[model samples]
Target: MIQRPRGTRDLLPPESRLWQAVEQTARAVFGAFGADEVRTPAFEPTELFVRSVGETTDIVHKEMYTFEDRKGRSLTLRPEGTAGVARAWIENRLHDRSHPLRLYYIGPMFRYERMQAGRYRQFSQIGLELLGADSPLADAELLLVLHELFTRLGFDDLQVHLNNLGDPEDRPRYQQLVRETLAASREALCSDCQRRLDENPLRVLDCKVPSCQVIVADVPPVSTVASEASRAHVVAVEDQLDRLGVPFVRNPRLVRGLDYYLRTVFEVVSPKLGTNAVLCGGGRYDRLISDLGGPAVPGSGFAIGEDRLVDLLPDGFKVRVLGLRRLYLVPLGGAARAEALRLARDWTRAGVVLEVELTGRSLKAALKRADKEGFAAVAILGDDELAAGTVAIRELATSSQEVMSPAEVPAWWAGRS
Candidate 1:
């Protein structure tokens, strides 16, 4: 038999229900915040990511899934969501609509990387972007939404690790500082960090290698040489967060892997997964649109790694979503089976969650199956009940049974629910 590719997964029953609940929660929460959904192609020109995410980032340099299409033009599965959003903003002329477009997207992203627990080559992301606004309030709003989302998901141990990467002008000075500080320990640095020292010195701070991290620990925070204007911008963001009571910690060494981010960069980490596992990461990318050949429009946003989020989902949330009550309908005899569909349709129209037993299994077998599958109750329709215009309802938990008219079953189920 043919097997599925190594890095992909089939989100099967019950487990798939958890994913649906997550997506639905995201939609309701983001929609309440005035964020409309925007969807782009699963694949785009290879140049899109290179131009927007930067040439030196790992997403572009190592992880991207790029190939030549039938027309011999390079195409790539999107490795991240932000760059695609920027490209869509330019190509579709979204600038004409309104200032500060609030858009959210949930979709699969592809990356060719080594598989790990909670990480996949094919993964999904839930992202929100606020475009065309540079105000500190916009940044605060994003954080508020994030806090609300995690709260709704029942995550209590997550933390926001925030830092100011400064404005574009301050980058030259900051990069110089990193190079100078790590110069003495250059030989001890990893091969990746040594090459990044000249190409993109700030990338050295983001290195995960134990040796590189030790050397990078001594470098001065980027805020030390930040331009006065840039410093003021991030300070305002922090003040707003404080006023709003959204908790966060200032981590001097925090740096996002993408090149477009500047000013406010952050990652939300879960102690349950250890500090290295980032559940969500995003920041302000004021120059992304202009860099993508569009009018300069500032934007701030973040993407939650949906795969990992579900993997580390709180036990309470899993139980609530997966343990929702559903009724099993058992039809006895050929005549009862034929009439079952009509009753099932009527009850479902009345907002009842149920499934009719399609197979001709015996009543004893059907009840056993219902109990094993955790059905709240079983509705039994037989030749006698069909003739009498009534049904039997059996509560699995209480082992209680009641006879009622077909129309009354819906109300009874609703009451129990």
Candidate 2:
């Protein structure tokens, strides 16, 4: 039998409720912050990522599933949503309307990597991007949105790991310092870290291996090694976070492993998940639009991994639906079945969760399944009841039965509860 691909999942009933809750909270929070939703296509031209997400990054270099479409147009499933949203902002001319277009997206993102327990090839993400603003107030607003979102989600003790990549003017000096430090321990560095030493030194700050972690810990913080301008910019973001009463820690080496980020990088991490499974990540990208061949634009935003966020959800709250409380129509004979189906629709119109046997089964079998299915109460339309324009309704939990006009069943149910 064919099966779902590796690193993907099917959300079954009841458990699917968690996804709804997450989406609901996100919508409420983002809407309150004036961020309208942006829905972009699942696929885009391959160069979008190369230009915006950075070709040297792991997402582009090792993870993207690139292929040519029927028309020979190079398209690929989007690994993340931001670049496409940015492209939409440019293509739709949204920038001309507002100062900073606040936007959020929720959807599946694709990646090809070795599947781990919580990792998947196709996972969902809820991300926020604020385009066309550069003030610290904008940064503070974003941080407040993120902080309140986590608090509202009931995730306590979340650690915010904050850092500064420093703006473009001060990044080169920090890059030089990183290269010099990496040169001293280059032999001890991992292959990926070594290769990144020159091109994007900030990435080496994210190594997870035991040996690499120890070595990287000794490397000077990017803030210490960065230019004075970089230092000042980082300080401003911190001051904003403090002013907003958002708690955070300064991790000198907390550079996210991406090339598009120019300054003010940050991560909201949860130590509960065995030391640093990041819940959200994003930073500033001042030159992304220009690099991608659009007019210059400043962007700062973050992506929340839904898979991780769901894992952090408290247990027992499930997808709540009108389940077994449904009125099951067990017509006595063929003609009665037809009448029962018609009655079921009328009952539905009155806001009743009603079920009629679809399978051509014996009355006893239908009754058995109704009881087994845990319906709250069932509406049975045997020939005797149908003759009177009435149905026999049984309350499953109480084992009580009554006769009522089909139209009155919904009101009867509302009264029953």
Candidate 3:
């Protein structure tokens, strides 16, 4: 038998309800922050990511699912959300409307890598991008949005790991520092870190290999080499976060894996998800719009790995499934079944959840089935009830029965606690 591909999942039944809750909560929080929802294609020209995410980043170099179309044009499934949204902002000329265009998106992203807990080949991300803003407060505001969202979702213990990548002017000097430090310990570095030392030395700090981590521990903080302006920006962001009561720690080695990030960078980490799993990561990208062919615009955003988040949800958290009202209709005869179908239609149109039984069953058997299926109320229709144009409604909880017109059933159910 054919099976689902590896690193993918099928969301079924009540589990899907949980996913819906996450999305709904995200929408409510994002909407309150004045961010309108935006969607982009699942795939785009291969060069879009290569140019925006950087050639040496793991996402572009190893994880992207790139292929050629029939016309021989290169295409790739999006590995992340910000680049696509930035492209749309540039292509659609959203900059013409307002100085800051707040946008949010939630959908699947593709990447090819070893499947681990909370990591998959096909994953989902909920992200928000605030475009046309370039201030330390903008960075703090994004962090506040993330903190509010996770808190609302029942996470009380979360650490916001903060850092500064410095502006373009400061990056070269930091890069040189990283190169020299890693070059001295090149023999002890992981294979990936060894290659990164030559191509993009900053990425070596992001390596998880034990030996590489040790080598990076002695390296000086990026802030040491950052220009005065970049250092001041970090101070401003920290001051705002303090004012907002959003606790964060300075991790000078916290350079994000993306090329577009400049100045502010951060990750919200949850202790519940083990030592290394970050729930969300984002930062300021002041030049991304221009890099993607639009006029110069500043933007900052973060993407939450939905899979990891769902796993981290509190055990007592509940999702109320809308439109499943636990009302069942059981008919004892052919005429009663026909009448039941009619009532089902009317009740459904009136926004009542009703299930009509098509299979013929004795009244005793029908009531038993309703009880077994956890129906809150069962409407029994027999030839006598049909002739009288009414239904015998039994409250499953109390085992009490009442006769009411088909039209009155909706009101009666609605009035029940």
Comparing candidate 1 with candidate 3, which one achieves the higher lDDT?
1
Is 1 or 2 the stronger prediction by TM-score?
Answer: 1
Query: Which pairs of residues collide in model 1?
Result: none
For model 1, where is the 10-residue window of minimal lDDT?
Answer: 268-277
After superposition, the stretches of candidate 3 with alpha carbons farther than 4 Å from their true spots are 319-325, 345-351, 358-374, 395-402, 415-417
Minimal lDDT window, size 10, model 2:
315-324
Question: How well does each candidate superpose onto the true structure, as a TM-score?
Answer: 0.98, 0.86, 0.91
Best by TM-score: 1
Best lDDT goes to which candidate?
1
Residue-level lDDT tens digits of model 3 in 2-63 = 99999999988667777899899999999999999999999999999999999999899899
List, residue by residue over 271-341, the lDDT tens digit for candidate 2. Answer: 77775478899888878777776788888899999998887764423323223256677777878877866
Quick one: ranking by TM-score, best first? 1, 3, 2
Candidate 3 TM-score, true structure as reference: 0.91
| Model 1: residues with Cα > 4 Å off, grouped in runs | none
> lDDT values of the candidates?
0.91, 0.80, 0.88
Clashing pairs in 2: 324-374, 324-375, 324-376, 325-376
What CA RMSD would you report for each candidate?
Answer: 1.1, 3.1, 2.5
